[model samples]
Target: MKLSVSDSDLLGLVHLIRLYGKNLSKTWSYTITHLIRKIHDQEHFPVTDMVKKELNADSLNKYQRQKLNRRLENDSLMIEHMIAVQSIINVIMKFQYSKNDNDAIRELRSILEANTNCIIKFAIKEKDLKGI
Candidate 1:
């Protein structure tokens, strides 16, 4: 299948490969989440005004609003992004740890594709891509 990857996604993949090298584990949720959040903060995009409006509204409970605000302020989608990644990571890691090399590689490819899809959605929203 054809994969559509953005520049940011390519950079992230390259960074991940460099960080883990051949020693990469299929289960890299913890480290990857930390890295994603750090990178997002360093980039420092202001939270969308919509996010602030949502936070200001009373529709969300106090706890939920606070959590939402924190996430928005950081401009990091760690909570949702990590959730998307973990399941795929688990599937690939299981196959790898079981010595199923072919299946492991296939699953890894699927995981990467899924991640690219997520990043595309995020970039479209974050950059406010037209006609999206």
Candidate 2:
């Protein structure tokens, strides 16, 4: 399939990979942990009464487990993410090693085409891509 990846999206993936390497789950874990800490010690997560009341009903451990089940998103998707990251990194290496611009572009386009779905998922889900 012919996939059109915008330069900005490509840059975003590059940025994300630099921050988290091949592990996108670290970003998800950090975000959840940060919120949990705010809710527990700081009591600053849900300043409003309604949200706080809702959360008060559930134990923090249970809440964290639920979040992990949802965010981990199973091993298959995570493996795809890892593969996609490595493929993109390979393209970067190609550009670095090869003096021929055309050769590098061809290699990049090939990798992007082969891993279109995973690459797009990475580019689009910038919300979960964060620094630890």
Write down the TM-score of every candidate: 0.27, 0.27
Per-residue lDDT for 1-132 in model 2, tens only? 354444444444434434454454756445433432232231111112322253342222334434434754422111113233434444543443233444444554565555433211122233353221
Candidate 2 stretches greater than 4 Å from native: 26-109, 117-132
Per-residue lDDT of candidate 1, residues 50-94 (tens digit): 544544432232244346547664443221232344454443334
For candidate 1, the TM-score is 0.27
Candidate 1 lDDT: 0.40
Q: Give each model's whole-structure lDDT.
A: 0.40, 0.36
Total colliding residue pairs, candidate 2: 0
